[model samples]
Target chain A: MTLGEQLTETSDALLELILAAEDIEQKEKLREQFDVITESIEKLVKENVKKNSKEYIAVTHNLNAANQSIKEAIDDLDKIAATIMQVAKVVEMLGKMAAAMP
Target chain B: MIKKITVLTLSLIISGCGLSVTQREAATRFASASTSVGDFSAKEFAAMRDVTIQMNTKDIALGGKAKINDLDGAFDVDDVAIRINAAIALSAYGDLLLALVDDRQSRDLRNATMQFEDSLRGVSGRTLSDADLDNLGALVYNIGGFFLEQQRAKALKQIVLRSKTDVDHLCDLLIQDFNPTGLNLLHAVDNTSKRLKVDADMALAAHKDNPKSKLFAIQAYRLADSQRTRVKKTGAQAIAVLTALKSANAELVNALENNSEFLVDTRLLGVKMKNLGLALKVFSGS
Candidate 1:
């Protein structure tokens, strides 16, 4: 995939992570990590990072390689996602118990 | 040969006079930029404090029900404290610059500048000689064209150097505190999010076993979700503010660095002061 395609895919994944985040704490953590990556991108852009720059080429190449394996990695996350939803359900149930108490 | 020497000396003196004009313009530009940095820093810190207060309030309310600890205390207090300190330093520095340039109408400013200078000397452990002090007083009192050439240059250079040092120190202090405060804010937001998630999960579990309590469980989950979203949005804004502040600090430092126009003009002023010294020596046959 091209660099633009990879970035688009990365952005989608990040959005999913943010939406699925269990609480504001988790969302903040995810955003902070995202900020670090974006800050680096900003610096590179400011420096006029050229297409021929070895680092840029290497990063795009590595990301493309990593993209192939991400589907399997996401499959693993499904199990964790199920567990989190279950926990959320349990917390909702407890809130009912507390409200019903004297 | 005598005529040639006389002409050369006259040209040097004329060039030396021109240096004072150049130095005054450059010093004015530097002071204006430095004031902007101070104003920007103060405004950013105040904004940070406001955001921190909002987050802290949410955290406190959440902590009453959840297992979250308060991580925003330090930031909530230090933000205002640091901003006030920066304002005072900037004001004193501005007063000193004005006292040097403005006429006798700035009498109160002159006294304020003297007090600030004394405080700075106490801190830096540097003593001005009696003659140097007299020259400075003369410069402050004789606002317009009534000063010796070398004394005026010396006083201007001294004031510029002191103002530069003060602004640089303030910037250093701001930069030093910024990173840790940003991190603390992030941590507080993160913890609050986590605690809300756990609370929502517990409420969900209780609702599973108690059908009559379904409404309560739904309300609890909704509240937690909304609070979490609010904290996340605010935390993101705080991060952006900090990023802008860091950039401002870097720009201020760059303007004051040795290669910048401000410092180059200052060096030119030093050269002019030296030329005046040489003229005095030649005329006095010393």
Candidate 2:
């Protein structure tokens, strides 16, 4: 669990213990103080997560590979059929020249 | 010659038939859904920041110890920027997957895989380890390059399988950030709504004697109530979107593994994404 979660759990456990206190006078006073402590703990937990989230997000590398370079490379691949046709034409002309020489 | 033409045509047909129509559709739908989740989260993070500022403003107006100068430091702009970039990166990840199966656009799967390697190299400094790079290289060049060739199904499966761990990690991070239960984005929004309602209640109580002021206060209260409900509903929808995004990737992998038709789930996920988009728009009041 995260530190924030652990703090929250601990705070809840403290609240439970406060609720189960046997001494009535002390229990009431402690509950009031405990409420303030719980509230502070809640805020602390939120801030902790928020601070950690920044670091988490910062390390998230962009996994998107479909950019200008990739698209251009794919576009070049798309011209393969036309390039093959040019190669075929050159080969055909060579065959014709060979026939003429014979 | 004529023989060459016949051989090329036969090969094209066989390659095209490698992935079934249902499989292609499922992959496409999954890509779209994941991309939507990414786009939504990116925008939602900005909205969350705005809501935080508004909450701070309300707290000050309610007689709390804060000033206008404090508003400037109310939010972490750098953190929000990183969140937005991370979300966009996620969308880009989906685009990479779509480019693999999308025959009309990316016919040469080999080049696509290579391009991804080049792109990964560019971003490697930020996060990817050497081991991660080697594994990615192996996945792209060896499994994706050699055995899969240009076969869409096998290539997509390889990409999805290779990306599943990262995808889960990313999704989990986002889920934690947006989870309604914790003191995250949605919780902040909920608190903002409650603060607004408190302001409205104060207005109502203060203006009880003046009829005109009372009318305006009542309107304010109604607006606050409406906003609170909208926030609640949108919070639920946000969770649903994230859940669907994670499940869609997992289900796509499963469908590919079993070679089963999972169109129904994809279609449902698509609709859910659309609904969440609408909900978000309503919540944004844009």
**Top-DockQ candidate index:** 2
Docking class of 2: incorrect
Predicted candidate 2 versus true structure: per-residue lDDT over B31-63, tens digit per residue: 877677878889878876775576546545544
User: Residue A9 CA error for candidate 2 (Å)?
Assistant: 16
**lDDT for model 2, on a 0 to 1 scale?**
0.57
Q: lDDT at B50 for candidate 2?
A: 74
- Residue B251's lDDT in candidate 1: 37
Work out the iRMS of candidate 2: 16.3
Q: Number of the top candidate by lDDT?
A: 2
Q: Please tell me what DockQ candidate 1 reaches.
A: 0.01
Compose the digit string of candidate 2's lDDT tens values, residues A1-102.
754355445544544554456554554455455445444544653584567565555436424432333344344434542343344345334434543452
lDDT for each residue of candidate 1 in B1-286, tens digit (9 for 90 to 100)? 4344444544555555322443554545444444444454455455444544544444344332322343333343543554545544454444444344333323433454355334333433234544443444333323312222333344445444434433444444443333222223233333333334444444444347776455555554555455445444433433333334333333334443332333444333334334433433333321
Best by TM-score: 2
Question: What's the TM for model 1?
Answer: 0.38
Rate residue B119 of model 2 by lDDT.
Answer: 49
